[model samples]
Target: MKHINREVGSLLTRIIEKREKFLRAGDHKDDLLGLLLKSNLNEVEVNKNSDGGMSMADVIEECKLFYFAGQETTANLLTWTMIVLSMHNEWQERAREEVLQVFGNNKPDYDDLNRF
Candidate 1:
């Protein structure tokens, strides 16, 4: 939680500053970070120092959600996969061999992951 708090806080701070520069110049785009980036990105449209944008408290809570949700989903998947593999080494090795045959120990591509 601490690590998530620090990382998200820093990222959000930088994003907010960048958003300010854009807004001041009347720039707009569909960048995901365009609105969500700034702490006051939306608020600044009418009120420069308004607190109408996502609040620090909300951002902090969101960071907790991201960390918990992301970690739990991925960790559960990996743990279950590893358990299944350990219970069936032969099947696991066959799958591994097929993977090596296709990718040959190199990094995978988006296409390959999509297929998997």
Candidate 2:
């Protein structure tokens, strides 16, 4: 697990490094770190739990988890998709056509995913 974790970490770092290279070329942000940050919830509602509001620290940790989980899942899905397509070229073509038809605008909505 450690070896596999290290390999994944290394690859992710490389991916981010490459993305940063493009930004260095011309991109700039008012808050570079802010651009990398996101919250899973817009706001915390008041509950019986004290003053009620997602603590900033908790928000940050959750964001890290969300980012890592999303990245890893996406990576695995793409890898498997490629392997499956290679092993079944006929099915691959059909899948491509369906995807194109549903998301012909190049943007897929939640509804489109359900069709899959």
Candidate 3:
């Protein structure tokens, strides 16, 4: 258990370091991490828990949780979608057409996500 915790701690450290490096490099993208870092709150301010903000540690843990949960959910979704599509190629083609209509070979944005 201690080894596992140590490994997780190391992973979080690496993630934080990489994010800090990116910030130092001025590679600011408009994402969740960008928004959080832009807030310019210290770990102490975040830990105050007064405005639904999170500490650095909490952000790291949330990122780890989101990564694992999103991975599992996406895998399951693709698996089931493939199984169903194999049984219904027509529906699969229709689905593809609809997606093409919605996205037009471009990346979907937040507004597009809500259309579904």
Candidate 4:
């Protein structure tokens, strides 16, 4: 388990570094990863002045937790939603129409989700 954790941690560290670089070069987008990157920068500044801030490891751990937990939950929800939609085609069509109406071809933002 310890070895597995170390492997995962190493992978996550590389991922975070790459993401930081992408964030620096890419256009701004409001999303969870973007928000976390902002938080990580703030935490770094805070840690420079005091010891009461999150470390890089802590931020990495949080990113890992969010990735795993959020991915699992979203996957489960999508699986169940697909199952339910399959069982009820009428509702599925309705949902598809609603999504198209709300978001068209673009991804839904927070306001769109709330309205949906």
lDDT of each: 0.72, 0.60, 0.76, 0.80
Error of 1 at 93 (Å): 2.4
For candidate 3, report its TM-score: 0.53
Best by TM-score: 4
Q: What overall lDDT, based on C-alpha atoms, would model 4 receive against the true structure?
A: 0.80
Residues 1-116, candidate 2, lDDT per residue (tens digit)?
88975675666556545544554565544443324421112123335445554554544445457778989999999999999999999999999898888688678778768776
Q: Backbone clash tally for model 3?
A: 0
- Higher-ranked by TM-score: 1 or 2: 1
TM-score of each: 0.52, 0.41, 0.53, 0.56
lDDT for predicted candidate 2 compared with the true structure: 0.60
Task: Name model 3 segments beyond 4 Å from true.
Answer: 21-27, 40-53, 92-116
- Lowest summed lDDT across 10 adjacent residues in model 2 is found at 37-46
What is the TM-score (0 to 1) of candidate 4? 0.56
lDDT of 1 at 13: 66
Candidate 2 displacement at residue 8 in angstroms: 19
Candidate 3 lDDT over 11-70, as tens digits, reads 887876687678768776677666666454444356675655565677777777877898
Count of residue pairs whose backbone atoms collide, per candidate: 0, 0, 0, 0
Ranking by TM-score: 4, 3, 1, 2
